[model samples]
Target: MWEAPEAPPRLTVSALTAQIRRQLEGEFREVIVEGELSNFVAHTSGHWYFTLKDAQSQIRCACWKGTNYRIRFRPRNGQQVVCRGKVTVYAPKGEYQLTVEAMAPVGVGEQQLAFEQLKAKLAAEGLLAPERKRPLPLVPRRIGIVTSPTGAAIQDILNVLRRRNDGVSVLLYPAQVEGAEAAASVAAGIRWFSENPDPDFPVDVLIVGRGGGSAEALWAFNTEEVARAIADSTIPVISAVGHEIDFTIADFVADLRAPTPSAAAEMVTARRADLLAEVGSMASALTKVMHIRLLRERQALETLARHPVFDDTQARLRDALQTCDELTLAVQSAVQNRLRFAGWRLERAGNRLRHYPWRPYLQLHEQRVSELTAKLIAGVQAQAAVAQHRLAQALTRLNTLSPLRVLARGYALVQHPDGRLIRTTEDAVPGQDIVIRLSDGRLLGRVAQVLPEPEAKPDPPPHS
Candidate 1:
């Protein structure tokens, strides 16, 4: 009945879209949607586009790189996920879509899913093999630690190390142990220790850990960056992250795993007293071996001296004497080599124990090493002197058995013209030519006397 209603206000396509966008954004400013993910696409611009659908309907969603970076897990097609976002209309497409701010797995935490995924991936790469692990140094001169400088973990480690008073030089690399940047920081610390070892005191091992904390707080150690850092470290790494029950990827990839930071510190340092005792035992054993060898050499020389064959065979005696000299030289060389090797080992141990800000025990160690060296040298010298003296006496005894000395004592050797010895009166005829060899000179003459000898008288029986 009224005049035709004024034409409804016409809207441009852009205007319509703007109006719809406003209503949708206002109404769905924040929402959480759960569905099966499909048509997933990660754009070159670092944005993610996907469809979330159920049996009945579907909705398009976009996760900008800025927002998706906060998501712990990677989104994949056909996965059931929960997305939180706002709804807005696209002006060009005339469609409403979700601008996803965050996302997670439908039933599990994103962090847990990510952890599992990384674990499986690394396991497949053989990084989790027990054979990949390396043994820690028996004694570490410098220990490189990665953790929060202000945290209880550092304090706990320091307390443990101090309690033992192992005199291990510790180099701390301050890093965030929690939060998003923690993984990067920890990895950087590990890599720094690996690439840039100290010129004077290189890091012997690395300790990567933190104080016990909640799962969220300890997740940095669970990340790929930190795990890879531990795996690739040139230095042996001990992963001491969280309490005994809390495990991280770093724990699996590290060369050794400790349950806590304090425990890690304890594990790294061998007791100085125990190591010194071991060194002492080794030295004592070596000394015993050397003494036994010298005794054997003396026994051999004594046996050779007592043998009657040495008195008759001058060549054999000379050979025996030469052998004795050789043996003596060999024994001397062997002792020196053993002592040198032992000294090398001790010096190496001392270097490891020689921590920075030199501890008092270091001086004591130096003294002990010097004393041991002197003792070894003195013992070797004493043994050598005894051997030389014995050898000289043996040579003197051999000299008394010399034929020249017998010849000098009014004895002479008669020889035939052909240089054969004249032993009996039957062989030495009156006309045979003979030579008389004396200590001073030789005489050539005809054999003029080969007389027969008279019978000698027999001895009487002993009186009862």
Candidate 2:
């Protein structure tokens, strides 16, 4: 009967699926879908599989590697996304899915998201640590620059370098700084300088950057490949990206960051006026130190001249000479007294002899008196000579003990600023002021450094 309006044109399961797939692909070829991502899987074949779901419904999605390269941010589960793609069905499973051609996050920009993701990854790997950052050279002889040859950045840098220091050499590595191919070009320039260093004109520092622009125009510097190249460079890198307000991934990875290309040039070269100022400052400080030293030395000399030891030495010498003169006078006085007493005795004896009887006896007595007088005179002369010898010896010993004599023999007396003598290393410390007393004058100085005493060897192990 109409019984089977003759199941006219029966179709196989494969044919049914093919018909459905064609219908779905043709109708939703250019559709846009908004949903939350879930169950994302990145296959080894570089194809992405995931589910796009909303509170009310869900659909399967696939993104091939060839098409997903345009997506800037990495996809993750639970992220809301807006996808532009076509709908199709897998014939084998007879299931339907959306083939994603392009995609982006719902609220954030693709570049910003990509930047944050890369930043987090590099930070986790310790590339952003302050300890990893190297210091730029204080005085760069030759500066290497990587930037666009025709852009304003190169002109600004060259002008700054010329103005700051004409002697400093500059080598330019022309590179593309803004576009899809810019990252590789910039990285190649940096690696070229790093790999091929010029011995005759060595590049002391590197500047990699561009002039200010919109975020999209400056996206090349924010790329991970450029960042890694900067980090891997052996030479110190200075990142001079956009204006003061702009920040890029290269800035964080570089050894130093400059607000602008001109600022980087200024940092690498020293101004002539600044150099002269520094030299003048050092000279002024030295002159001041010398002036202070001379004043201290003059004061020290005046102090030594007025010391009590010199006065005491002079007083002792005077006293010794006075005692010698007193001893000489006393010896002469005793000799004179002895002569007078002898003469008196002789007169009395002569009178007694004249009154007494024998003439021969008187003559004999006169001879004896003359002989005794000569002997006593000789004894007094010997005593005076002995006294003179003792006095001369005493004067010589006193002269030998004089402090001035010691100083004249090239010995110096070291003392602290507070007038205490410095006898050992412990009494003086580095940077301490000290006075050195010489024969002619005194010197004022400061201790520069201190060294520890060497450990004494144990007598060579008793000659074992």
Best by lDDT, which number? 1
- The regions of model 2 sitting more than 4 angstroms off are 1-106, 270-278, 303-464
TM-score of each: 0.53, 0.45
- Residue 215 accuracy (lDDT) in model 2: 65
For model 2 the local lDDT of residue 385 reads 62
Model 2 poorest 10 in a row by lDDT? 297-306
Against the true structure, candidate 1 has what lDDT?
Answer: 0.82
- lDDT string, candidate 1, 140-217, tens digits: 778899999999999999998887764668899999999989999999999999889777779988999999865657
Root mean square deviation (Cα) for candidate 1: 16.6
Candidate 1 regions off by >4 Å? 1-114, 123-139, 146-156, 163-165, 171-204, 210-220, 224-236, 242-246, 259-263, 270-300, 303-355, 395-423, 426-430, 435-451, 454-464
Tell me model 2's lDDT, rounded to 2 decimals.
0.78
